[model samples]
Target: MARLTVPLVLFGALIALLLVGRVTSVQAQDIEPRAFSNAPIGVNFLIAGYGYTRGGLAFDSSVPVTDPQLETSSAVLGYARVIDLWGQSGKVDVMVPYSWLSGTAESAGQPIERIVDGFADPRFRLSVNLLGAPALTLEEFRDYKQDLIVGASLQVSAPWGQYDNSRVVNLGTNRWWFKPEIGVSKAVGPWTFELAGAVTLYTENQDFLNGGTRAQEPLYSLQGHVIRGFRSGVWASLDVTHFTGGRTTINDTLNNDLQRNWRLGGTLALPVDAHNSIKLYASSGVAARTGNNFDLIGIAWQYRWGGGL
Candidate 1:
């Protein structure tokens, strides 16, 4: 009937845009998994990754600490493109990261250590889909299918990376930041569900460290995902995130570091053919009050190509 209801509504909108292309996050109370996705119109993708983290940071007894530790490792690269817009369906992505960090802190008790590497803040994103999706190709997106869809995105963070005014712990955070998001997805039978919300905005860092001046406020997030699909292409996911406020200030004083966090993660994707794929992930910090109490692991490799262009 109607060609089997348009391939079951384009296969439930392609499994809700493959669970919103697996949302991604970095720092500032991060947690991500499929932010809302659906693809077709041109297509292209590439990704590479490695990550490791272990942390503990709680500093706010006015200004001075007693015990803190952090360890980090990273390497990441990404690219994506899919477009149409006007008729809807759009995408764009970029990410670049490189880091290595080591830390230990204590003030009056004495014991300070620091090690650093380079590159960190670099990200860019833009997404659109605004309801049920459209703009197809790749042979009309192989027939199309959907149940619900909605999307919006904007992400940016670029301070170039590797900054030092004399270090306090630097990888980068010299300034600039952005985030604005909204997402929704749904499917059934083979499962898919998602939700998203975000707010992160900051800019101000006038040297800070020896020169001093920094500021922050605004960071609020919420995320969720549940995905499942199998047979050949494979998929799996279960994730959660929550975040609240960001408080900081330097020369003007005030460094409450306010943040209420919660996170939990999981992901698995495997294909290795028809354009290749492989992904695995992990996340932790079930709850935290200040910030940074981490555990993470990652792996990634993905490739795909322009469909018709």
Candidate 2:
């Protein structure tokens, strides 16, 4: 036990230092793009290393129960590209994400906890923008001093990760899920506000683990930001999610009981260059099953570069 302490402590300390630097050097609300020129083709990449502190289970109508603190972490990478349209003002963007999860969890009264490590399910999303800004705008609409933009998105979860088939923290569900959503954005002066919502259609999971079931899911998000000026901005965003639609079937019998969960978080962004940015965020659950309430702290560095010829 003592032998493992040094590495874990070092990792935690490093992340802590980064967070401190992010918080003290600048305020999250002051980053912004100086110009809105559309590029013919563009690419963006994001890398995030996250830590999850609490681990527990929340069942229908039951308070959450915590066994032990399961220190888990994931390294996620995403890539997106813009498809040129007309010039650069309008475009289509598609992104893919891959991640790895590792950690250990212990029960409250249990003497020991188990180690968890595996690849996460891959995710894909596509978006198409209409009436893009800073590139092309209808003369009539432009006169209204309105920065209206609309888009649609489709996302899918592929069951391509490693799975224990009996544990809750597996990489794949062994079943596929998909979602469709619409988004709207507007800019007023130096502020930009966005709203998006989606619904998930769940498929049957014959081998669902931990007495799990398949169900429909709903997600909604709202983000608002004010760019104090170019290259700096303070932004606030909130997201809400709900899960319910599947039956708890045990031994071919249905247990009408359903499970639900939710999360909310906010972040501040600062640009280090034309293609690089830094963000600091803190999140926690408001109301959740007893074992479901936990807090999260994170920092992300993003870079946008390269694109199609």
Candidate 3:
């Protein structure tokens, strides 16, 4: 155990330093592109952003609500680091979000409304390139071109946000979730194509609303992206996603709410300088499962350093 102390301390310090730098990301219904791309070891990222949504805001689609007319404004900070893992390229990252939500909905045939603000669940991820990417320095990374890369990642969302047992709509779920995913990225000329599949498993929320216990089945998701890159350090992508199968049970009573939803979005990233970049993104639900219809638009700024840069 003593032999592991130094490495653990170093890793903790690394994450602390990056968190002090600030960063950003989205959590639910995630549709991120280039998530598995390789980067030079030791490179660090700082991202900060804000997002606005109209219609609904439920971490799980089966929130037992109907005809929701809601809006959410979210602010997030995130950080990421590239590391060398067993001669392969890997990354560790985290994102935290704070949200102000205002909404109205019908529950059990009663009209309800709430205006609330608080921190949302934070997410952390660890990813490693399994094939077609090797650990490299900045110099080696400059001359490298990607063809086919396969990667795997695990993402976790912790129950660190505010939750009210009396309110049906809140910023937190009072539960934990894990997502294990595998992805493939292929670069073709100036275009890149990527696909990912994941399953999100949830733990029971013991202190659910009305002092009842709540449990959910796993949710499965698949997403695809088509990206175009230019020589001017600007890139864009079209994204689509489908997720299904999150049936909820409350107090031994099974709810008829099962989720099958689809969303479409796009992202544009423009590099302003060697250390600064800007990103614009938008997504809309094409098919929603009850309390899951929403439209989102967001913009973020990113800063990169280290890795001898």
Candidate number achieving the greatest lDDT relative to the actual structure:
3
Off by over 4 Å in 2: 1-40, 44-53, 56-69, 85-113, 132-146, 210-262, 289-294, 307-309
lDDT of 3 by residue, 144-245 (tens): 788999999999999998899998888888899999999999999989899999999999999888688999999999999998977655678899999999
Tens digit per residue, CA lDDT, model 2, 54-155 = 443211112112343444454544544445454334333222223333344433333444465565555565555555533333222223333676656566
Runs of candidate 3 exceeding 4 Å displacement:
1-24
Instruction: Record all residue pairs in model 3 with backbone atoms less than 3 Å apart, i.e. clashing.
Output: 23-47, 23-77, 23-78, 24-47, 24-78
lDDT (Cα, 0-100) at 146 in candidate 3: 86
**Candidate 2 lDDT score at position 181:** 62
C-alpha lDDT (0 to 100) for residue 295 of candidate 3: 88
Candidate 1's TM-score:
0.32
> Candidate 1: lDDT over CA atoms?
0.70
RMSD per model, one decimal: 15.8, 11.8, 8.1
* CA-lDDT, candidates in order: 0.70, 0.42, 0.81
Q: Please tell me which model should have the higher TM-score, number 2 or number 3.
A: 3
- By how many angstroms RMSD does model 2 differ from the true structure? 11.8
- TM-scores vs. true structure, each candidate: 0.32, 0.63, 0.91
Top candidate on TM-score is 3
Candidate 2, after superposition: displacement of residue 67 in Å? 5.9
- Tell me the deviation in Å of residue 39 in model 3: 0.7
